[model samples]
Target: MRAPAANPREPRRHHYVPRLLMKRFAVERRPGQFQIQAFDKSNDRVFATAIENIAVESDFNALERDGVRVSLEAGMGKIESAAAEPIARIVQGGTLVGMTMEDRAAIDLFCALQFARGTGMRAQFSALAEGVEARARAIVGADARLDLVGDAEGMKAAALQLIVGSLLEFTGRFNDKDLLLLQAIEGEDFLLGDNPVAMQNARQFGPYGNIGLGVPGIEIYMPISSRFSLAYWCPTLLHQMREGAALADQRLLQARAMSVVGQGVTRAAALAALPEIEALRARLRRIPDGHLAGAAVAADAGNVTRLNSLQVRWAERFVMSRDGGFDIARRMIADDSAFRQGMRPRLD
Candidate 1:
């Protein structure tokens, strides 16, 4: 006799990084079992676990709202389903060319949600709360605050509210950027961190410099699989690819001026009136209607290494690799004192 079916509403384990994605970096252990290599930064050790085991927590996305039991797992599952096909096609084709606008929107939403929903962000929220509490205590000189501060479940609910609230705004920023496919050369693969979306400023290397999503020269890197990682380049930097950096900066100023004046006019009319603006916009559009209808150029070794390093530095916990190679991570941890200490708040 068969046992009772599992309850969809009462899922115990929920993944921050959707398993649909983890499967790309996982190895088939047996007939249906899949496993991926994991490197724990705390212990400075490497291990492997089933794909379902890592990047998951119990009731991570489940919470109560207005006295109703609500689970976001189902909604997140829908997003995973929507993105699976387009992601598979891109991985198989090994390129971003010829992708439909609908597909681009799907992937953009997936990456944005992935960026917001994670243990890393949760930890950051917790740290920020603690910082605020410390300051409050200093000013008031007393242990007087709401119970929410120390209550684990309450904190989780608050974090979820913030995550879901700002999702659309974050996705908008992602949509404004253009995709730059970073293809790994033969025998090379990208690592997937617990906090998979690595946000950085390639132009500015100062430790405390601004790397906000809307800031100029911001680069958002998300590893799609072992073979491909998507680098969303800001418009200014994308312009810099053809023109020099200085010219790209100047062009952005001009574009901003046009954008301000073109507010009242319809987009079509504005483009019709401004030939130069139309040409610049056309150059920035990479996916649809672009001539790059083939595989993207393979990234150099240095590029791959730098991308991998971002995964390490930005990660809140362990980072995973497809081939169980941890030499790069190990070397970095051994040499860098900060890494050994563990992940700290980006500002602090």
Candidate 2:
């Protein structure tokens, strides 16, 4: 028989969502002690705790490889460190503007890591593994000498591999979308979930939701702070915006020409149109391999609520904010049975 895997010496409290990101939505409970208000969906309870105490699982990233036990916690820490400055800048300015290419890439990887490393994702992978094992067992019948699912160590190894691989896969896909920083309107705030990266497709509905990162109309939201959120707009949506802007400009120009004949109206019209043109350009434009803070948009109360609804739906267990405000989340849970289950893979 194979020897059992040894316990890893690495950090046990592995945080899937980085503490740096969580700290943005934290309140200073005491001197140098920050606390965030969290609502646990499982128990239907709201509580206050440090950011370090939540969004974590014991040895969640630990794995056995080459007869050695290791954890990906350190590697995850490095990703958080890389993204710290850029994200902090966005929170401070309440915009996604003026980020460097490297900063953008770092944030992309970090977001992917957050999505892949969550309990929701890990549970989905586990369920998939179980389903495959069940099918394999039935196919092999009594002739099977070993468990198709392999040992715990082997499973851990596989999970670790999948998490890292997904992070890398998603980073490139996230790069394809247009980055925007969304600011919550006055008297409204964004919420953070255990699974912070809330993904949805506005163009898709019914039993077939398009969760694919590369798919058009995919909307990805991550609340960086209670006041600001990071969003990735679908390429299709950006295309539509650009097309609409062009058509509007053309119509306005034609109308001006028809109304004012044989005057130097072209120059005056162009000058007058400069501000509108710049505004549209900022909205529809992006820096090559970077992000523009000018793309920041204000989210009205309705918009903020809509985004928070995603956080509630995407969260595995808890949805939190700077304050213990969960009126929307509470209502959703009470009204919809589906919201109680949150986002999970359909094994069937």
Winning model by lDDT: 2
Clashing pairs in 1: none
Best by TM-score: 2
Q: What lDDT tens digits, residue by residue, belong to model 2 across residues 1-348?
A: 443554555578888777887787898877777899999988788999998899887777876555566678888889989998899888887666677899999999888887777777765666667777777777877476645566665666776787766777888888888888888888998999888888888676557657867877898998888998888878777677767667666756665554456347765776576567556555554322234335567788998999999999988888888979999888998898677655766544
TM-score of each: 0.79, 0.81
Q: Rate the local accuracy (lDDT) of all candidates.
A: 0.76, 0.78
- Stretches > 4 Å off in candidate 2: 1-9, 65-67, 130-155, 205-209, 254-293
Candidate 1 C-alpha lDDT tens digits along 144-174: 7644356677778876886679878888899
At residue 206, give the lDDT of candidate 2. 57
Tell me model 2's lDDT, rounded to 2 decimals: 0.78
Give residue 186's error in model 2 in angstroms: 1.2
Position 192, candidate 2: lDDT: 92
